[model samples]
Target: METLRHIVLFVHLIGFAVLFGAWAVQAFGGKREFTRLMSIGMSIAAVAGLVLAAPWGLPDGAEMNYAKIGTKLVILLVIGALLGIGTARQKRGEKIAPAVFWLVGILTATNAGIAAIW
Candidate 1:
């Protein structure tokens, strides 16, 4: 079980890389829309995060930081929604605001901050 937790955490990290890495590249390159790959990576990270928390849900000696996790979840959702909105705007031939890109980029980085500093 311990090994499984570590594996899932690693995957979560990988997902973060895929999602944020892609975002960073696109945002820096002046691309506004969310890539399909980024969405896929975000989905993977979100699911793996929940799975990694499964053991803590057990009625045993397991303990977890629900507050931190909840905060992280909200951040992740905001990033997803922002990306979705940006994608919609792109599809409509509208430009996504620069602030939206910055917000999503910073919020995505905030997950790492939450993990390290929370």
Candidate 2:
């Protein structure tokens, strides 16, 4: 069970990497549009994160940090929303606001920071 937990945690980090890597490529490569890869990465991260939030493999008497989990969940949801909105708008020949594009990257980094620090 502990090994499984570690595997899931590795996957969670990979998801973050994929999401951020895709965003970085677009943001710095002269294009600021959403891609399917971003959505896929988000899904991976969200699912793995939810799994980690559970207490399945934890040792006895170890309490889960609900507050931190909740905070990260909320941030993830916001990132999802932004991705959806930006993608939809882009598909309709609309230009996504610079703020919206930048926020996605900012929030992604923030989420990783929270996971690492808290």
Q: Candidates' lDDT values, in order? A: 0.84, 0.95
Residue 75, model 1: lDDT of 90
**TM per model?**
0.89, 0.97
Q: After superposition, how far is residue 5 of candidate 1 from its true place, in Å?
A: 1.0
Count backbone overlaps in model 2: 0
Which run of 10 residues does model 2 get worst, by summed lDDT? 30-39
| Model 2: how far residue 92 lies from native, Å | 0.3
Best model per lDDT: 2
| TM-score of candidate 2 against the unseen true structure | 0.97
Please give, for residues 1-118, the per-residue lDDT of candidate 2 as tens digits. Answer: 9899999999999999999999999999958898899999999999999999988999889999999999999999999999999999999999989999999999999999998999
Give the least accurate 10-residue stretch of model 1, judged by summed lDDT. Answer: 53-62
Off by over 4 Å in 1: 56-62
